[model samples]
Target: MQNESSGPDDIASILSNPILNTDSYKASHYLQYPPEASAMFSYIESRGGRYDRTLFFGLQMLIKEYLCRPITPAMIEQAKAFFTAHGEPFNEAGWRYIVEHHGGYLPVRIRAVPEGSVVPTHNVLVTVECDDPQVFWLASYLETMLLRVWYPITVATQSWHLRETIRGYLLKSSDDLAQLPFKLHDFGARGVSSAESAAIGGAAHLVSFMGSDTVLGVVAANHYYNETMAAFSVPAAEHSTITSWGRERETDAFRNMIARFGKPGAIVSVVSDSYDLFAALNAWGTELKQAVLDSGGTLVIRPDSGDPQTIVLQTLRALEASFGSVVNGKGRRVLNNVRVIQGDGVNPDSIEATLATMDQAGFATDNIVFGMGGALLQQINRDTQRFAMKCSAIRLGDEWHDVLKDPVTDAGKRSMKGRLTLLKNHHTGEYRTTTLPVAVEGDWEEALVTVFDSGKLLVDMSLAEIRSRAHAHEG
Candidate 1:
C-alpha cells in the first residue's frame, strides 16, 4: 500500500476508497479515531496551506490511523494553533526544523539487528546517536516509537526460537512429511499497557510467525499479511469458566455451550482448566472429541494450568486411548485430529523446558499445540530486555571527541567510545567486535537504511517474506 498522504485532499480522497472496509482494514478499536475537523484547515492555513508532501503525513497516519486513539478536534485545533504561531516557509529543511524544534525530531543514529534477525541478550540491538548536544533530553519521548519498533523485533525473535523448538520435537516424534499447519496466537492483550501497543505487539508476532487471535493484531498484520496467510482465529475469552456456582452446573453450562455452537466441520477451541483442569479434561475430552468428529468438526483443547508438558502428555494419552486411532471417512483420525493446545505462562524458557520434558516422557509432540500469551508477546519486550542507547562519539569544534562512560557500575552497562565499526566474524558470521576509528570504514557496511521514503514503502515485504528471511538467516 502507498504510504499515508498529507493534505486534506489526499486524506479525503483516500478515505473514500471502499477497500478500507475489507477484513484487513476493518474499523476495529485500533482503527477508530475522533474525526479531524477544522484541524486540517487550520494547519493548512497557518502554513499558507502549501502541501509539500511531507513525511509527517506518514508519521501522522501511523499515530492516528494505526494507533487509533482519541485525536479530538480540540487536540487537532491546539496543534494547528501551535503550528500557526511558529509557521515557517515550506521546505524539507524548514519542515525538518519545525519537527525538530517543535514537533520533536532528534537525529539519533540507531544500530539494530535487521528487522527479522534473531537477537540475544546484551547484544546491542540498537544504538541511537544524536549529533545535537541536547538530544539526550528528548530520549524519553523517542522511547515510545523506539520501543514500538524494537519490541516486535524482540518478540518475533523469541517466537522464532520457540517455534523451532516445537518443530524439532515434531520432527522427532511425528511423520516428517505431514504438514503440521502451525499457528502463533498472540494472547498479550491483558498484559500490554494499552490497546495500541497490544495490537502492535500481536502484529509483530504475526509478521515473524503466523496468524494471531488479537483483532488489533489482525489489523496490524493486515498491513503486511493481506495477500499471504489471510486467515486466523480468535478465542472467546482469555480463559474458560463453566460459571461461578457448582461443578455439575459448570459441566451443564459447558454442554450447553457445545449444543449452542454445534456447527459441523468448524474448528473450535475451548480452554478446559476452570475448576480442576484434569477433571474437566476427563469429563469433556471424550464428549467434545466425539461431538466434533461425529459432526465432521475439529476440537482443539487448550490447557492453561499445571506443568504444560505433563498436562499435554496426559491430555493426549487420554484422547488417543479413549477415541482410538481410526480416521473418519474424511481421512481425519479422531485421536490425531484432536489438538491439545497449551496456553498461559508460555515463554521461550518454558517452551524449551516443556519440549525437553515431553521428549523425556516419550510423548508425541504432534498431539500438542501452543497459544502463547504474556510470555511471548509482553514479557521479553524491548522495555524489559533493553538495548543500550549511548553517545559513543561526538564532534566538538575542529576535533572529534571519543567519549566513554567511566565504569562506576556494571561493566556491561559501560558505554564504548569513538565512531566505532561493528565487524562480522569471517568464520562464525556473527557480530564480532566494536572496533576503533583506525579500522577501515570501507570494510564495514552501513546497517540501517530508509525502508520507507517519500510517503511510500520503499520495500514491500509480506509477513511470510519476513519469516522466510528469518528462516534463511537461521539456517
Candidate 2:
C-alpha cells in the first residue's frame, strides 16, 4: 500500500496504524462475537505476582501516542493487504464504518486508575469498553497495545519498592532522608530492548528517584509526562573512560576527572575497578587525597566487580580508612569526602543485602548509592505481576451478560465476572472491587475515572504530580 506522502510519512502512518497494532488473532475476532453483540467490556489487573501493590502509570503516554490519531483509508488498505497475506481475516467494513461515521476515531472508552497510585494487585486497574455499538470489537482490538502498560507499571512498582526499602535503611542508620531521592540511579537505557522501552521504563523509574543516567528517560518524562526535568545525572566515568588511560596512567585518569568536574558542590563518579580497586583506593587516600579535598567536590567511587553485598561494605570501609569518618548525630559513620556506588549485580535483593550489611557495620546509608541496569528495565515480564486483560462482561441484544474464566486446574487464574468498578471508601481509606449493577451514577465516586473517550484524552498527568502520588502512598 502507498500514500500520497511517501517514505517516512508512509512508514510513520503504517507504524502508527491502530488497526494493525493488535495481534493477528484479533483481526479475526470481530466476526467471532455473537451477531447480537453490541458492546464488550474488558479490564486489566495484576493477578498477583511479585509485589502486593502495583503502581498505575504509562496509560497517558499510550493514549497520546497511539489512540488520539484518527485512522485513514491508507491504514485500512495497508492492514487489509497485510492481513490477506498473513492469513488473518480483516474487518474492512468495520474499518470503513469507523472512518465514515466516527471520523476514523476509535469509538472506545478507557477508564483507569490515576497514574502513580499504588493499589493492591488482583484489582481492576483499567477497564475498556466500546462506546459505539457499531464497533463492539474495538475494546478488545486495542488490548494488544493497551496491555503494554504492564511494562511501565511493573517498573514503577519495583522502583517504588526499592525506594521504600532504601528509605527504611536510611531511617534506621541516617539522621536525615534528604538524600533519599538520589539513592537509586537508573542505568537501564542501554540494557532495554528498544528505544521505546528505554524511554518508557526509564521514565517509570523516575517516578521514584530523582537520579538517572538514562537521558532518554529524562526526555520521555519531559515529553510524555509534562515534566521540565524528571531526573538528573552527574558526570560519571565508565569502564572505557577509565581503561582508556591505560593501566600505567590510571592515577592520571582519576586526577584528570577530578580536575575537570570536581568543582565545589559537584559530584563526579569514577569507576575504580579498571585496574586494582584496592590499589586505586590506596592512591586516592594517600597521593590524591589532598587534591580531592582541595577540589571541594565529592568523588563517588564505583566498584563494578565482585560480590555487591560484600564489596559495597569493603568499599565504604576502605574509603573511610583513607579519608577517615565522623560520627553523625544519628550515630552512624559518614565517610568524609568519598562515597561508593555499587553498580554491578544490583537488584532488589542485593540492594537490601548491601544496606543491611552497611547498617550492621555502623555506616550511614548516605555513604553509598546504587545503579541498576537490566534488572530495572529489561528483566521484568508480564508474569512479574501476572498481568492479564480479560473480558468480564458483554452486551448482547440489550442484555448484559457476565463473562468469566474459572480454571479449576488453577484457582488463582480464575477471572473476575460482570462489569467491575473500583470503589474507595473515603471514611476508611480502603479500596474494593465491586460489580456495577448498571452504568455508574450518583454520588458514589469510582476510583476508575475515564481517561480516554472516542479519541479524546480526558486526563493529562504530569510527572511531578505522578511522583507526589507515588510517594504519598508510602506515607
Candidate maximizing TM-score: 2
lDDT, candidate 2, 62-139, per-residue tens: 999999999999889889998999999888999999999999999898999899888898899999988467888988
Clashing residue pairs found in predicted model 1: 109-129
In angstroms, the error of model 1 at 49 is 50
The alpha-carbon lDDT assigned to residue 89 of candidate 2 equals: 86
> Could you give candidate 1's per-residue lDDT for residues 1-475 as a string of tens digits?
7656654335554333221212222112121312221000000000111111100101221322422222223333333333345542112332234244634223333343345543333333444443343332222223434434545555555566566667676666655313333545666777777777676667666644554667776676665544444337733422434545356666665565566554675666666677677676677665555665565555677777887767777777676776555433333233654667778667676677776776675555655667787776666633444433444554554355666676767664566555554454434545533534444344454433333221233344455555565666435
Whole-structure CA lDDT of model 1: 0.49
Error of 2 at 59 (Å): 0.6
Worst 10 residues of 2 by lDDT: 437-446
